[model samples]
Target: METDSKISKKTSQTILKLQQNEITEHAIYMNLAKRVKKQGDREILQRIGREEGMHSKLWSKYTKRELKPQKLKVTIYSLLSIILGYTFVIKLMEKGEVVSQNSYALLTKEVPEAHKIYLDEQKHEEALINMLDEDRLQYVGSMVLGLNDALVELTGTLAGLSFALQNNKLVALSGLITGISATLSMASSEYLSARSEGNADAKKSALYTGVMYIVAVILLVLPYLIFPNSKYIHALVTMLIIVVLIILSFTYYISVAKDLPFKKRFLEMATISLSVAGLSFIVGILVKKFLGIDI
Candidate 1:
């Protein structure tokens, strides 16, 4: 009696597994057929249906149990699977509502066996959505990247100008004007771009970018104020400022991304700064050689 009871339990579990696979296969075949619409649909349906039949045969072989119609379990599982799968696919598709509804209708009429798989997949989708929402800081690296860009470009502009132009009130004034104008222009563009983002945090990104630009510009002009009329000295000062900006940018990046080693970030920032400063210096020398005329 005990052995028979164990066999019955195992047979019942096997039947449930077979039914579940049938429901899943039905959903897959219906979705693929709806999207692709080829004779391959019949082939896919037959292949999956055969797998379900094989599962049933395996259960029969093991326990000599015949497949019975468990009306309640099949009905409940089928409805759940259809609902879950339909909900997920419909939401993901742009104009999927009409297509999803039509597919569901056709599926119910044509492939009733595979609906259970759709429910399992829907559960998986729900789990993924929940995980994404839980990890809100996933895009923080992007914010750090934007900040780094604002710092390097603005500071480099000031540094190159300091190198090329005489370190005097005029150069300082130019830096101030250029910094303010660039910051405002950048902030405005960022605001416009972020207006479509539909989040409070998006506006804050514009503010952060603007602030970094202002800070970088001010740092560039600091050496000029410290050593007035020292044009040669100021060239070295500007280079130092560029070095510091590179360091700060790298440090911020390292802090924001703790997984990245400091040496890697430092070398990366140094390479970029050197490349930019080299180009700017070359341009300045050519301009000074031709335009300054010093004549």
Candidate 2:
């Protein structure tokens, strides 16, 4: 009787495995439906896919089926592994809810079934979010570097140029124009580079970088508009602005990431800003000598 019972349990476990595989496979197909633009069609398909797996698990659990000792351990381990792996990936996917919501905006484009799956996943994501602490540095690092880098580089570049060009209105105008164009170009280049690394939101980092650059340029160059007669004066005022920008950067880092030492942070920013300025000064001297212009 015990042998017969064991045989029955093994048969039930085999059936559960088959059912779980079928459901998981179907779920993959339903997910792929998005690539083919079958959003609504994929919704029902997705639910069906999930139901299949649930049904299999429910059956095995309810039946007290004794799967082979090794196989049962492996199955338990695999499930645990999946849950752990998806915790991080699912949060990332959740962060892109804005993108997914847009994907479902149009009625014609809406895959009702896919939409359902999305909604379900959204809830799942929310639950996961509640379980996980919110300190993951998803967009913050990119944004911080974008803003800080632009402020340092562009401010130093313009100040160095103002020193070299010294009070020529035309030279100042030319510098401003060049800086604006360069900022935009750099931003676009960064965005494309990030996009190649993967994900649409990744491109936003470049935009933020470019925007920060424009702010840096404006902060430095705005003083020149009023003091066009004395490039030296403009350069002096811009230096004051640079100091303010540096302090602000340090303050921001302190506020957001309190672990960094103030002196270390200040030195890092100063090193980069001064290094760029030095390089720009050299470039300006070479251009002035080669072109035979007094700029």
Candidate 3:
């Protein structure tokens, strides 16, 4: 490792930034480790935290200046870990480390230890992959089933109802009734399916599915409820937009956690969902005309 005897001002500033980042990340890992229940996972996070602390020390040597961790960064990442799950927060942090890894390459000439730090960062990614054991992730299929079914079925139902009913309040009322009934039906179906499959946590799986479905129902129906005086077409458009956003968010989460392709999954789900809504819309128009129904 080269000494800082001839380091330039710019190089010193960069070293300080790296030192800050390392120490801040160390705090994040340590904070999350303390929150986790599993001893094995806690130990791994502590080990990584110690490695980050060592990297900060290495940078401190080059700058010959003491560095403090950024409290804000630590707090933000800690909160994200609590809300989004440790696996997601860690993966997100690793993505940031990739940027730091590039910066480390630039500093290798001035600080040879940067190369070693970069290698350790790569290892951290692999370690995180092995440490992921979130219960929600294990039952991702149940959530997916619930979310997708609600999106496709409710979106189409609402679309058809918008045309057939042609009144926003009526449409909202009809949607709420249908959504609640379907949520219960879906929950019971999931419970039976999981039980048949011999899943030990069949009840929990069913609860997750039902909760996810109800969440989707509430989100999709909100526009109708909130804008009951608006045009039904406007409400339908808002609902579709909400559906697309939900698909994007859920697909991105699955992509990051499961190492799946984002674009393909997102496009496929969105296409099927929208296609069903479109067909349902046309059917609604035909039925309304044939039945000569006017509200």
lDDT of each: 0.50, 0.52, 0.85
Q: Which candidate has the highest TM-score of all?
A: 3
Candidate 3 lDDT, tens digit per residue, 77-111?
88877866887777777766624656767778777
Each prediction's TM-score versus the true structure: 0.46, 0.45, 0.92
Report the C-alpha lDDT of model 2 over 36-87, residue by residue, as the tens digit. 2334434544455465455445435434443322344334433532432222
Off by over 4 Å in 3: 1-3, 98-101
TM-score attained by model 3: 0.92
User: On lDDT, who's better, 2 or 3?
Assistant: 3
lDDT, model 3, position 121: 72
Error of 3 at 293 (Å): 1.0
Error of 3 at 61 (Å): 0.7
Cα lDDT of model 1 by residue, 1-295, tens digit:
1223433453345344444444444444344334333354334434444544554554354344454544554455345335333222222321221223334334433335325434543465344323322111343443454445655564456555655675545566776787788778776766677677775566666776676567666766566665666563564456456665657664644443233456666767767766676676566567777787331
**In model 1, which regions exceed 4 Å deviation?**
1-146, 235-242, 245-253, 256-258, 293-295
